[model samples]
Target: MNRSACLIFNPVAGQGDSEQDLAMIRAILEPEIDLDIQLTTEEISAEELAHEAVRRGVDTIIASGGDGTLSAVAAAVVSTDISLGIISRGTANAFATALGIPDTIDAACQVILQGVTRTVDAADCNGHRMVLLVGIGFEAEAVERADREAKNRFGVLAYILAGLQELRNLHSFDVEIETEDKIIKTSAVAVTVANAAPPSSVLAQGPGGIIVDDGLLDLTIVASLTRAGAIAAAFHLFQTASAGNGAERNDIGYLRAKQFKITTEPPQKIVVDGEILGTTPVEIRCIPAGLKIFVPSREEEEAVEKLEGLPNLTIEEKPSPENSPD
Candidate 1:
C-alpha cells in the first residue's frame, strides 16, 4: 500500500522559487508517497483544493505558502482525519514558526516524510476558520499597513514599520466581551484571541505561552493610552512571553476561555490568521483537538514532555476527530 498526499502550492506567497521548491519536495517524497500538486491561482483556492483533495482520500494535505495560505488549507482539513503539513513560504509564516516548522523546502518536506502527527486545537469565528490569533485595533492596523510591496522589500520589518505608524495614532474603543463565565466591558487599543502563536506575537503571549492543544483560547487586551505607555506595555508583554509567563501589567489583561463573543462600540476591522476579515462583533469558539498536523517528531515530543508539569495548561492528547464538539 502506498501513502497519498496533496501539496497545495501558493505561487506568490513569499520571496521564494516555488518551481524549484516543488521539485525538491517531489524528489524527496515521490518515491514513498503518491504526491499530487495543485497550484493556487487566487485567494481561497487552496482551501477549495484542499477540500477536493480530502474528498479524494488523500492521507495528508500539505500547504506550501505563507500563513494565509496555510490557514485556508488547515481550515479544510480540520475536524477530518487527514493530517495537515506545512512548507513555509510566507512573510511572517507565524503558524509555521509556532510549530517550529523549518522554512527551508527540503527541511519542510523531510518533516512530512518523517510521519509524525499532533492533534491540535483550532477555532471558528463567525463561520471563518482560525488556526492562529485574531487581532483587532492596533494589530489589524499594522497588518493593513504591511502591504505587499513592503513585504516584498522588507519582509517582517514591514510589519514593524506599520506598527510604529499605527502606534502614533492609537485610540481606544469600548468593547464588550462575553465568555461562558463572565461579561466584561472595557476600553481597549488591541485585543487578541489566540489559538496558537509564536513568541514574536507578543500580544498573544499569555502566562503559559500560547498552547496549541490547550482546548482554550488566550485573550490579551491592551488598554494603554499614550504611545510611550503602549510601547512599555508591549515590552512588558514580550518579556513575559519570553519567560513563558502570562502578561502581568495593569494595562495589559490576559485570560483563557473556551468561547468568546466580542462587540465593539464602533465596528473595527479584524485580522484572522493574517488576512483581514470584515468588522467586529464576531463569535469565536474553540474546537478542541480539531486539527491533526505533522510536526517535527523529536522536538514536539520533547516540548510536550516539558509542558506536562505546567499548571493550568493541559498536555497534548491524541483525541479522536469524531469527538470534536459541534
Candidate 2:
C-alpha cells in the first residue's frame, strides 16, 4: 500500500497558519506515503512544481491550497495516470467542497491515504485549464473586486460584499452561444460554464446537481435582473441546487454541452477557477475523465449524500501498485 506523492503546498493561499498546516499535512501523510513536500513561492509556482513532479514520474500530486492552486496543479496532472489530492486551504475551497472532500488537514489527508479516487471531467478554456466553473459578467466583476488584500481581511465575506455592491449596477449584454447542435443568441447579465461546482455556486446549478463525471459542462445564463430580481434568482437557483428542483423562472436559462463557443458584445471579464483570466469571446471544450482525484467513497461520504440534493460521486478504480510510477 505504499505510494510516492509530491505535495504542492501554497503557503499564502488562505488566512491560516501555513507552518502548522504544512506540519500537520506532513505528519498525517508522511507516515502513510513517501511524501515529498514542495512549497509554492513567487519564484516557483504550483503549476511549475506539479510539472516537475509529473516529469519525475511521481505516483500522485497532492495540492494543498485553495481552488486556484488545486486547479493549477490539476492542469499539469490532467490526462496522466497520477492521482490528484486536495487539502482545501482556500477561502472558498469550492472544488473541494463540491466533491465533499474534508477541509481539515487531517481529514483531507486521510481521504488521500484511503486511496479512493475518481476520474472527473476537466475543461480547456481558450487554452487555459479549468477544473471548476468559468464565470463571466456579474460573477467576474465580483471575483475581480475581491482581491488578495480584501480576501485576507474579510475571508469569504469579501466575495459577498463585492457581489452586493455589483448587484446594484447590473447591466445586460448581447451573447451568442454556439454548440455542436444549436446556436442560441440572447442577452444576459451573467453566464456560468461549470464542470464541477458546489451548491453555493447557485448560477452553475442549471440542472440542480452538476454531475462531475458526466463528460459535459453545465451552462447557466441569467438575464438582466433588478437588485431584487437578482436576489430572487439566486435564491431560486440555490433551491434548485439544494432540492433538485428546476430553475422555475423564465429569466434563467440552462443547457449542457461538450463544447461551447460564446461571443459577447463588449468583452466581459472571465474568472476561471477563481482567477480572473481574461475577457470573453472564448471557446471551451470538456475533457472527459481527464483528471483522477482522491475523494471519499460513497459509503464513506454518507454524511454529505443527502445534505444538498447533490448528485452521486463518480467512483473510479482505486490506484494500485501496478499503476504507480517509478
lDDT per prediction?
Answer: 0.88, 0.89
Model 2, span 92-177: residue lDDT tens: 87889887899888889999989999889999999998888899899999999888898899988889899999887798889999
What does candidate 1's lDDT look like per residue over 1-326, in tens digits?
77888889998889877788778888988898887889999555888999899899888888998888899999998899998989898898898888778778888888898998889999999898899989988899889989999999999899889999998889999999999999999999999999998878877775548788989999999999999999998899888888777777888898899999999988898999998999899899999999999888886446644555667986578779999887
Task: List candidate 1 stretches off by more than 4 Å.
Answer: 299-326
Against the correct fold, how does model 1 do in TM-score? 0.90
> In candidate 2, which residue ranges exceed 4 Å CA deviation?
303-326
Clashes of each: 3, 0
Q: Judge candidate 2 at residue 111 and give its lDDT.
A: 95
Candidate 2 lDDT at 207 equals 79
